[model samples]
Target: MTAHAPPPHAAPNAASERTERWWHRATGYQVYPRSFADSNGDGMGDIPGITSKLGHLSDLGIGFIWLSPVYASPMIDNGYDIADYRNIAPEFGTLDDMDHLIAEARERGIGIVMDLVVNHSSSLHHWFQAARASRDCAQHDYYIWRDPAPDGGPPDDARAAFGGPAWTYCEEVGQYYFHFFSPAQPDLNWQNPALRAEIYDMMRWWLDRGIAGFRMDVISLIGKDVDARIYEEGPDLHPFLQEMHREVLAGRDVLTIGESWSVSIETGLLYCGRDRDELDMVFEFSHIREGWHPELGKFAPKPFDLVAFKRALFSWQDLTRDDGWHALFLSNHDLPRQVSFYADDRAHRRPAAKTLATVLHLLKGTPFVYQGEEIGMTNARFERIDQYRDLETLNHFEEQIAQGVSPEAFLAGANRNSRDHSRTPMQWNAAPHGGFTTGTPWIQANPNFGEVNVEQDMVHSESVFAHYRRLIALRKESDLVTFGHTVQLMQDDPDIIAFERRLGDERLFVIANFTAQDRERELPQGLAGQADCLVWSHTPRGEIPRSLRLVPYESLAWKL
Candidate 1:
C-alpha cells in the first residue's frame, strides 16, 4: 500500500488551515446538538451540556466536533431554519455558552464546525420578516420573490421538497416566495450581490471567532435559476458558485463541506474542483437512497447496488484523488439511523451496529460519527402519525394523503422511511427521557432505551462501544484509513461488502455480511498474501475462522 504525500502547500489562513489541515491527520465526530446532551435540564440538549462533555468526547481521539445547528429558530425545521446566523438560541443557551463550548473544546483539542444553513433562512429571520411585511422593505430582495402568474397564483410546476407547491403565497407582499424545504425556510437569493456579500461576511465572522469551518446545508440549492422559473440550478449556478469561490473560499484553510445531496460526480467536482475553488468537498446521496421504490418517490429505500455503490464511491475518490477531499457519512440529523437501514433490526441490534461501524469507520474518506452512532442507536418507532414532529415527515404524509393513498398505508411507509427516525432524543440511559433531560423532553426518547442505552454498553467490554473505540483507535493509528487509496475486494460476493486500503506496503481488507446469512468469499488471487484478522467487529472465538465464513451480521478487517 502506498500513501499519498500531503498536498504541496497548507491552507492559507491559520484558522482555515486549522479546520481542513487538522482533519487530514485527525478524526471528526458530528453532534446533532438538540439530541447530543442536555445541560439545562429543560428536557433539551444545549451548549453547556455539550461543553461539559468535551473531555469525554475529546478523549475519544476525535480532533473536530461538527455541531448540526445551535442557531436561533422557531424549531419548525429544528435548528436548520436559522433566524440569525450570529446568535445562539436562548433555549440552547447564549452566545457566551457557545463561546464556552468553543473555548473548552479547543482546550480539549476538539475544533468546532458550524452547521452553516446557507441555502435558506427561517421565515422569522429579520430579513424574512421585512420581506413579509412589504415589497418596499430593503430586505425584500434578500429571499426569492416572484410576481403571481397571469392567473394570479404560483406556478404549479414548482414542488416543495417536503411536498406540495414550492411557492408559498405571501398575502402581505402579494407574491409567492420559493422554498425548497418547509415554507418557513425561504431560499436565499444568492443572485443578489449584496445578499451574497452579507452571507460571506457571516462566514468570515465565524472564522474570525476561532471556529474551524462549516457543514453547508442544502448546497445544491444555493445557486438557483435566476430567470422567472426557479427551484432548480441553472448554468448561472456554476458561475454563481465561482463568484463565491473568488470572494469567500479560494485559499482559506477552513474546511467547507457541502450537503449537495443529489449532485452528480461532475457537478460535485465543479462545486469543489481544483480550479473552481468552491468547497473542499460535497456529499453524494445516490447510494444512500438504496433499498426501496423510487417510483413511489418519497424518501423510499431502494435495494443495495454494490456495483453502483463501488462506482460512485470510487468516482468520488478518483475525481478528487489529487485535487479535493470528500466528506463521508452514514447518518445525520436528516436521515434514518444506518443500523436500522443497513443491518438486521428484527432481534439483534448489536451485531448489525458493530458490523455497520466496521464498514463505515474503515472507508476511504473522513468518517462522520453521528451523535449516537458510536453507541449503536437504532431508529425510533412512531406510534402515531401525528406524533411525528418533523416538518419534512408531516409534509410528506400530507402529500401521500392527497395522492389518495390510504392513511394506514401511507403511515406504514412513513414508519419505514420518515426523517423522524433520527430526530428522537439520544438514548443515554434507562432513566426517564433516556437521561437526556430531567424534565419533559422537547421530543420523545426512543422506547428501546432499556436495551439500547450508553450505560448498558459501557459495562459490556464486547459491546458496540468497545468496538467503536477500537475502530476509531485503529483509524487514528493508520494513515491509510485517513488518506490512502481505497479499492474494493470481492465486491460482488452476495451479502458481503469487502474493500481494501493500501498505504505503502501496509494493506488492510475489510469485509462485512450485510445480511443474516453465512457467506464465504474467495479473494480474487492478487489479495492472497500473509493476512491476519487484526480487527473483527464480530470475529468468532479462538480458532480465528481463517476460511472467511461470515456469521449473521459479522464483519472483519484484515491486515495483509
Candidate 2:
C-alpha cells in the first residue's frame, strides 16, 4: 500500500520532541482507587494498595496511571463530590501517602495523573457552607446561586445531568443553587475569577508535588450558561480554558486531558487543537454513547449499529488528523465493562476481549486501559439490586422505578449497563474477595475472578494480559502506530472493522470481527498476501494467509 500524506494542517506538538514526553507512544491505565486493591483490610482500596501494585503496572508496560479521585469527599458520589481539593481522604490516606505513591510510581517509570474535579465541589465543602450562610460572605459567589423564581420554585427549569431538577433550594439561604449532577455537588461559578484562581492554584500545587498532570472531570461543564437555564455549552468556555492554559499549563511538561461530553469535532479542536493552548487532548464520548437512547438512558441497553459507530469513529479520526488529538478508550469508571458491553461475553469472552483491545489500541490516539480490562474481566453479575454500590446505579434505579419502569426490568437493565459493572474490586487472584481485600469488600468482586484473575494470566503465554503487554511494546517500537494517519477500510460489512495506519514507507492494518460467526472476505487488492502479521488474537502471529478467514471475535494486525 502506498503511504498517505500528512493532513494539510497537521502540526503535532513541538513539545513531543522531548524524550520525557513519552505519552505520544505510551498507553495510560485508569485505576479506580476504591476498587483497585485493599491493603489494610479496611474493605476500601487505598494509596498503600496502589503502591504495592506498581510492580503489576511495570509488568503491564503502561506509561502512566490515571487515578480516580481520592480527595476528601462525603462519599455521596463515590469521590467525584470533593469536599477538599488539597488533602487526601482519611479513608485513602494522608498527603504523605500521595507523595509516596508519586515517588514510587516514578521509580517504575510510570507517571501519576490525578483526577481533577474542579467543575463542582461537595456541598459540605467550606466554600459551599460559607456560601450558604449569607449573601454578604466572600464565598457567596464561589458557587452558582440565584434567588427563587416568582413562585418560589427553582431558579430555572434546567435538568440535571444525572436526573431531576438542576436547581436545589437551600432553605437556610432562601435561594437556589445550580448543580449539573446531584444537589450535594453544587456547581462552581467560573464567572467568579477568584474561584477560577483557586482552582488553578490547587492544580499547580499537585503538579509541583512531583505529580504528572490531570484528568479533568466534567471540565466542559465548568463553562456553562451564565444563568444555567440549560444543561451545557456556554459562551465563555473557550476564553476561560485559554486563560487556564496560560496561567497553569503553559510551561509545564505535563499532560492535561478533559472529559468532554457531547463535544463535536469542530468544538473539540478548540480544546486540543495544536495551537489552541488548552488541554493536551480531550475525551469524546460520541462513539461510546452510540448505544445509548436519550429517553431510555444508558441503563436501558441498546445495540449499536456498526455503520453508525464507524461513521462517528472515522469522522473524529479524519477531523483530528491534523488539528487536534483524541483519547481512545473502550470503558472507564462510569461505563460498563467493555467485554460485556461491546463484545460477546457469553460465547466468546476471551477472544472478544482481545479483539476489542486490538481495535482500540491501534487507533491513532492515546489509548487507555481500565482496571481489569487487560485480564478479560466481565461484569459483576450482581443478582439483587442491593448488591450494587454505585450512587449512579441506585439513583437511576429509583428514577426509572418512579417513571413506571418495572423493578425487575430496571434491574435487568442495570445488570446489562450499570456503572457498578465496572466498579467491582480488581481480581488479583482466585482467593476470597479475589485477593483484593481480607475484610468485607466495599463492593462485591465478579464471581468469574477465579478464572480471570491476573495471577493466571501472567503465566499464560496467550492470555489477555500478555496480549496487552505485547500491544504496548509494539506501540513503543512503531512510530507509525503512534503518529500515523488513519484510513478506514471495508465499511459496508456490519460484522467487520478494518483500518490502515500509514506513514511514509511504514503501513499497518488492523482488522477485527465483531461477531461470533466465522467469516471470510477478499483482501484489499493492495494488501492481499503482501502484509506480514504483526499480532493476532486467535491466529498465529507470523504471516498473513493467502485466504482471509476470521473466527468468532478474532482480530489481527499486519505490517507491510
Q: TM-scores, in order shown?
A: 0.91, 0.95
Off by over 4 Å in 2: 1-20, 226-228
What TM-score number comes out for model 2? Answer: 0.95
State the weakest 10-residue window (summed lDDT) of model 2. 1-10
lDDT (C-alpha) at residue 175 in model 1: 90
lDDT of 1 at 83: 94
lDDT of 2 by residue, 353-412 (tens): 999999888988889999999998898777888998877788888888898999888887
Per-residue error at 303 for model 1, in Å?
4.6
